[model samples]
Target chain A: MRTVEAMLVAEVVARLCEEANFVLEENIHSAFQRGFEEEISPYGKEVFAQLLSNAAIAAKNRLPICQDTGIVVVFIDLGQDVQVTGGSLYGAITEGVRDAYQRGYLRKSVVNDPIERTNTKDNTPPVIHCRIVDGDRIKISLMPKSAGSENMSTAKMVNPSKGWEVIKEFVVDTVERAGPNPCPPLVVGVGIGGTLEKAALISKEALFRPVGHRHPEEIKAHMEDELLDAVNKLGIGPMGRGGRITVLDVHIETYPTHMASMAVAVNLLCCAARYKTAEI
Target chain B: MVIKRVNTPLTDEVVQTLAAGDHVALSGKIYTVSDAAHKKLVQYLGYGRKLPVDLSNQVIYYAVATPTPPGRILGSAGPTTAERMDDYTPALLGQGVKGVIAKGYRKAEVLQAMRHHRAVYFGATCGIATLLSMYIKKVRLAAYPQLGAEAIYEYTAVDLPLVVNNDIHGGDLQREGRIAYAITQGN
Candidate 1:
């Protein structure tokens, strides 16, 4: 069995926290250029320019790309043959997040309770999804979900009987209704099939995929392309100023489901698209 | 395509002159609110109590800024989703607030209130936080200090960028742009 030290995991998490917030994913960074080039609306063009510069300034100065540093969500893939030494895996992750937020000057957004709403002061106890997989390494993928776009994410139990058209309408409608609220141009992640919660999980997982990268599954990938075309045709544009490129990309993930259950979820990521993965 | 320079506290003439699709470089005093503090302000009026900070003729930006880090006057700052404040909006506008800065659309009632109050709604692009921080010169707690970020804070901004969204004559930038672009596909 391979042993991974708890302290090392903490350090990686802290680094990932800072890097994800400070440096946007490269695909998202490039999408801004494409957004600038393709945007037809004069106002849309201006938004693209600002978004491009916003990233440059954030990266150069080690400043957060967006002020809403966001609620941190992580997915941990633990190899079945690996053992975490020195501290609990959960403890290490929480410590890493707490240190990163304070040291990096990112906002602490987690509230202690849903109703009482007291600030945790430290962005700790991140939403973590753990999986046991083959291999001797531990992998961590992180996405700091901004409230604006996160608030706009939606899920519905769709009917496969009605087919792609039904799923297409729901996803497109969600983006249309979100309009300029969550900050467009958007990266839309769609999960079809699986149970309700599973659908939700994979949809967010789909976001970590690089922008403009097609799905490996040919059928699902085609759906992604069609959805992207339909959403762009909405002309919500960059910053919703109305243009041809409202959505930067649409990513879809599918899973086999129970006979009657066909759950669909759409997770929206703003242009910043801060995602980082680390292996230990 | 014309960009205007707007200073505050805004007068009726300034508010009336603005329209959708116009860009603006806004400077001067502004107040910021998170949803929590906004609820308190609206509740104060609901109970017929006086607010600690008067919003009359003043613009209120719907946002919560990050805490200042080393070597910065203020942390990265930008607009939050505006719809969360929709419940508190008409009350603020009715109380004579003239300008609102945020990203996204306001609800139907909020839109009506904008027209009735002759107020202006403006949007700053989302995710441009660090860039926008360059324009904020100063910040201080204005009221409800106990609420932390939920407390109202006053800001001094110079040439902060914004686009007019909803204007007094009933011009709406997002709606107009959305309709124009989507309709082109016969969609």
Candidate 2:
């Protein structure tokens, strides 16, 4: 078994936290440029311009892309043969998030409890999803999940027979209702299939897919294209003030699930679309 | 779009003149308040206690800025979702808060309160935090320093870009914009 030091994981997570907040993924910028070119509304074009400018300022000045630096969500692809040594893996990840928020001067937006809603202070206890995967190296994908866009997300189960049409309507409805809340133009990440929880997880995972990149499978990729076209047609535009380019892109991930269940989730990522992946 | 340059304290007369869909370049002292601070303020009001800051004719932004590093005017400061504070907003408006800044739809009750109170809702483009921070000419803690980022901070913003999402006359830019741009299936 390959032994990896826990402290290294912490350090990597810390770096990912800072970079993801400070940087907008290249594809996200490309989408913004694309949106700027195609957006019909004069105001919509302006929104895209502001977002692109915002990304530059955050990177050059080392400020977070958005004031809501958000709760960090880390997806860990842990190799089955690897052993984490020197400390608890969870603790190391927490330490990394804590350091990034403090040392990097990023906002600490996590609250310890939902109802009580007291600030956790350091933004520790990030929602880390670990999956045992092939290879000896651990891969970490980080997204500082903003509550503004996150609160606009939704998951639902529909009858398997009537799923396709229902899901399309559901997805469109969500974006319409979300409106200026999530800050369009948005990159919509969708997960279809699996149980409810699985759908939600993969939906978020789908967001890490570079904006505008298609799923590997031809059929699934086609679904993404179809959904993207439909969502953009909503005319929600940038900042939902209305125009073309309501969504920058739509990405979908699918998983096999119980025969009886047809669970779907939609996670709307704002134009900021901050995501970073590193392997260690 | 017609751009309106305005400064606070926004009075009833100034707010009444503004309308939805107007682009605004706002400057002057804007206070930050969100989530926890809203609860505290409303709770304080409930107890008939004098609030820490008088709300009359003030522009309050519904956002908590990130901690500022040395030599910067302010940290990344952007608006949060406006809907989350819908419950607390009527109270603030009742207390005479004149201008509100945030993104997203507001509750009907809050809209009614804005009309009754002669206030306006401005949307600072969500996720454009860095760009917005550039408008912060100065910032200082006003109250609830213990709430950290959620603490109320008095900010002097210059040429702060915003859209008049809701005006005291009950015009809603979001709704109007959507209606104008939403193409029906036949179209």
Candidate 3:
């Protein structure tokens, strides 16, 4: 068994926290540029240009692109072959997040209560998902989910009879209803099958895929393409200014479900898709 | 409803000329508040208490931000979803609030309030934190010190960009944009 030191996890998480907040990933950048070139709406084109400019300024100046930095969500893949030596894995990751927010001048968004909400000062105790895998390396993915988009995510458990048409309609309807709210030209992650919770998890996990990448399964990938075409046709445009490109991409992931259940989850990631990954 | 647009760094003349459906990119003094502060302000106004800052012709950004480290003025201080403040919006607009900066759709009552008050609602691009931060020149706390990010802080912004989602004249850009873009073929 390979022993991964807790400090290594902390260090990686720390670096990831800062990088995710400070930089818009290159994939998203390139995707926006593509959107800019394809956008017919003069307003949409201008908005894309400004978005590119916004990213550039943020990267060069080490500033966050948006004011809502968001809640920290970390997914860890620990190979069964790997054991964390020294300190708890979760503790280290949380500490890393806490330190990164403080050191990188990122905002601490975690609050104490859902009712009498109050900021917790340090962005601590991130919503972490740990999975045991087959390899020896430890993989960590950080996604800072902004409230604007996260608030709009939806999930439905349909009867198996509801089938593909229902799924597509629901997904399309969700995006249509979302309109400019989730920030148009959105990256939509659809998780089909699985249990109710697993569907939501995979939907979010699917968002970590690069902006233009497609799922490996041919059928699933085709559905993604079809969904993309439909959503873009909605013309929510860039920033919902009314353009041809309402959705930049649609990613779908699925798992076999119980015969009676067909769980559908739609997770929306806005243009500010802030995430970073590291392996140790 | 009459719809329009206003570019940022607005002058008072531009603000006054703004009719319904006129979308504006606003600059200058925009205050930040969220659910907690909104409740406080409403209560204070009920008692005829003077606000920390005069809200006349001012814009309020519906947001709850993370705390920044030492030396930095603020941290990812982007607008939160505006619909959450629907309950308090009409009251604030009644009290001379000229505009709102946020993300997402507002309730029907909020839209009505915007029409009645001749106020506008603008949506900053969602998740664009770094981009939005550059426009904020300074931050000054005004109320609800205990709320941390939910505190009412005044922000001086320069060319703080936004798109008209719901204009004063009752044009809903988000609604129109969706219908305009709906897929028909094999949709």
Candidate 4:
């Protein structure tokens, strides 16, 4: 059995939080570049140019790309064969998130309660999802989800008879309703054929995939392409200013569901598309 | 389609000439307020109580900036969604707030208030906080210190960039821009 120090996990989480906030991932950067080139509207092109420069400025200055530094969503794939030492895994991870937000000067946007709405002061208790795998290696992925795009995410349980066409329509309609609100050009993640909650989880997990990477399944990959084309055709553009490149990518993940119900969830990520992964 | 460089404490005359789709680079002093601060401001106004800061002819930026790091005037400062603050916007406009810098659409009531008050709504590109922070030279807490990041901050900005989405004459860039580029896909 391998022993992974909780301190090490904390250190990695801290670095991931800071790095993810400071740097725009290369895949997202390249996607933005492509969107910049393909954008037909002069205004859209200008918006993309500004976004590119923003990424550079954030990196050079070691600053957050956006003020809403976002609620940290950490996905952990822990090896069953590995045991955590020094501290509880959950405590260490939360500590890392707290230190990152404070030390890195990222915004503490999380509140203690949804209704009372008191600031948590230090961003803590990150939404952590952990899965135990067979191997002796652990993988940690962090996605900082900003409210602008997150507030626009939706999930629905559709009648199974509504089929794929309706699911496609729902995704497009969600983007359309989002308009400039979700900060298009967007990265859209669609989760289909799961339980209601599972659909939401997978839809969010879908965002961690590198932009433009396709699902292994040919049919799912084709649907991603079709959704990408359809969303772009909406002409919401960069910053929703109007152009041909409204969506940078569309990702879909699916699971088996009960025959009577089809659950779909759409997770919209803004152009920043900030995330990072580390494995040990 | 013209780009205009404007100074803050935006005047009625300047706002009148502006139209949707006009790009603006705004300099001078502006105040930052988000949902919490807006709620307070509107509540004070509703009760006919004195506001902590004067609003006449001031530009209000809808932002909740991150904490300033060492030796920095401000941290990442970008627009939050304007729609969330729609309920309180009309009251602020009624108090002579001249313009707002934010992203996303405004409700009809907010637009109507802009038309009535001759204020403009400027759309700052979302998720570009670090870039926008460069324009902010100074920042100070104006009110609601308990609110932390959501506190009202008075910011001195230099050529902060934005696009006019809604102008005094009922021009709506968001609506117009989407309509211009929207393609009809067959069923």
Candidate 5:
């Protein structure tokens, strides 16, 4: 069995947090470039240009791409053969988030309570999801989710008989309702065929997929393409100023579900599309 | 398509002349507030308490920026969603708040208040906080220090780019833009 120190986990999480905030991933950068070229509205084009420059400024200066440095969402794939030493795994991850937000000059957006809201100050207790995997290596990914887009996410369970057409319509409707609030050109993640909560969780996980990549299954890939086309046709455009390219990409993930249920969830990631991954 | 230059403490005449879809480069002093601060302001107004800062004729930007890094006047600062502030905005407009800078569409009540008060709503491009911060020359926390980033701060902004989304003349850019570009079902 391999032993990984809890402090090392903290260090990795801290570094990932800072890096994700400061840099716009390559896929998202390329998507922005495409949006700038394809956008028909002059106003939309101008917004895209500003977004491109914003990404550059954030990267060069090591500043956050957006002031909402976001609530930390960490996904961990832990090796079954590895053991964590020195401290509890959960505590180490939280420590990492605290250190990164404070030391990196990132914003602390966490509230102590949903109601009677108070700042958590350190940005601690990240929403962490973990899975046990086969290998001896641990993979950690950080997705800094901003509330603007996160607030736009939605989930609904449909009758299994309603099928893919209804699912597509639901996805499109969610984007239409979101309009400019989530900040287009958005990365839409759809999770299908699972329990209610699982669908929501997988929808968020699907956002980590590289932009423009499709589901491996032929039918699901087609659905993603169709959904993308319909969403852009809504003309929400970049910043919802109206133009071509409201959505950069649509990703869908699925799991087995009860025969009576057809659960679907949509998670919208804004143009910032901030996420990063590291393995050790 | 015209880009107009505007200054703070927007006058009724200036706001009345502005129309939706006009690009603007706003300069001069502006106030910043977000969700928590808005709630507090409404509560203060309800209790008939004097506010910490004067709102008459002042422009407010909906922002809760990151902590300022060393040697910087401000951190990545950009517009937040305006919809969340809808409930408190009408009351603030009644207090003579002349203009608001934020992103996204507002509720009918907010538009009504703006039309009634002859105020205007401008939308800064969302997700471009770092770029937007370049225009802010200075920032001073003006009230509610306990709210942290949600504190009401006075900011001096220069050439801050924004688009007029709602104007006093009853024009709405969001609806117009969508109608102009949305593909018809048959097509």
Candidate 6:
């Protein structure tokens, strides 16, 4: 059995927080570079350039790419065979997050309440989602979700009669209505066919996929492609100033759903898709 | 390049000279605050109490800064979304606040305040917190230390680059820039 200690876990979490906050993942960086070349509009291209420069400056300077450093979200794949030998996992994660936020100089954007807002300093107590996987390795994916794009995320329950056309329309309309608000040249993550909450979960999970990768399943892959094509057609462009590359990518992750209904969730990622992963 | 360090309650001469797309750096004294601090500041003012810091001729950057490790002057600090502060901006502007720096778009009312007050709203590049931190030469809290990142800290910067988004003469670079780029792109 693999044993994880509190101090070690805290250290891991701290590093994860710093990397996630400061650096743009290599895949995302490549995607932006590719987008710059593929973008037809001069405006679109310029926006892409600025974005790329911004990412580089952020990483080199070790600062957040956006003011909304985002809510710290951790997806932990813990091995069932592994044992945590040190302090509490939750406590360690929080402590690590605190240390990283302070030491790394990342913003502490988390608030205590949604309505009657109060801040929880240090961006502590990350939204931790742990899944016990089959192997001995523990994989941790840290995502800092900004509110601009996150606010536009939507989930809905569709009747069984509504077919793929409805799904396409719903997804397209969501992107169109979102316009430049989600910071165009966005990544659309779609979660189809699951219970309400599960669908939402899968939608966020889909965002973890590296840009340009498609679903392994043929049908879903085709659907994602179609969605991507349709979203770009909206011409939202970069920064909503209008352009051809409204969407940089579309990712879909699905789960089995109840016979009575199909639930769909759309999670939008702005151009600055910042995330990092680590294993221990 | 000439660098200017001026206090806020900005005058027409300062704001009129600024244009969108000009790469200018800010210096001198500025304060860091975000939504949480905004709320607290509003509340304090609502009760007819003096603010912990004076607003005259001062610029406020909408930011939630991470705390510095031991002995550091400050931590990674960057601008937050401007739209969130639309409500408080007018009030702050009315109270002799001169400049606001943030990322994202702002509403018309906020622009109107800038127009009326001869103030300028500057848009800093988002996600450039790391690069931006190098500009901060000094940092000290003015108020609300309990608010952590939301606390108001006086940041004396040198060449903190930003674009003038909304200026005193009702010029809004974001809207104009977006429109021009959209038309040029034919989208």
Top-scoring candidate (lDDT) = 5
**Model 5 per-residue lDDT tens digits across residues B1-187:** 5789999879988898889999999999999988989999999999999889899999999999999899898999999999999999999998899999998878998799888998899999988999999999988989999987889999999999999998988898888888778887998
Q: Against the unseen true structure, what C-alpha lDDT does each candidate score?
A: 0.90, 0.87, 0.79, 0.91, 0.92, 0.77
TM-score of each: 0.98, 0.97, 0.91, 0.98, 0.98, 0.82
Order of models, best DockQ first: 4, 5, 1, 2, 3, 6
Report the number of the highest-DockQ candidate: 4
Give the Å error, residue A114, model 4.
1.4
i-RMS, each model, one decimal: 1.2, 1.1, 2.3, 0.8, 0.8, 4.1
Candidate 4: Cα lDDT at A28: 93
- Give every collision pair in model 4: none
Error of 2 at A138 (Å): 0.6
C-alpha lDDT of residue B20 in model 3: 28
- Whichever of 2 and 6 has more DockQ, that candidate is 2
Models ranked on lDDT: 5, 4, 1, 2, 3, 6
Q: Report the lDDT tens digits of candidate 4 across residue range A1-280.
A: 9999999999999999999999999999998888788888988999889999999999999999999899999999999999999999999899999999999998998888899977788888799999999999889999889999999999999989979999999999999999999888889999998799999999999999999899999999999999998888887788887888888889999999998989999999998789999998
Supply DockQ values for each candidate: 0.78, 0.75, 0.56, 0.83, 0.81, 0.27
* DockQ-best of 3 and 6: 3
**CAPRI class assigned to model 3:** medium
Candidate order, TM-score descending: 5, 4, 1, 2, 3, 6
Clashing pairs in 1: none
> Which window of ten consecutive residues has the lowest lDDT sum in model 5 chain A?
A116-125
Give iRMSD, candidate 6: 4.1
The A-chain TM-scores of all the candidates are 0.98, 0.97, 0.97, 0.99, 0.98, 0.97
Please, what are the lDDT tens digits per residue for candidate 6 over residues B59-163?
899887655645667666666667888888877876778788886667777788777887787876554555577789998878998876677888988878776
Q: Write the per-residue lDDT of candidate 4 for residues B70-168, one digit (tens) a residue.
A: 989899999989999998888898889999999987888889988899899999998889999999888888999987788899999888888999888
lDDT of 3: 0.79
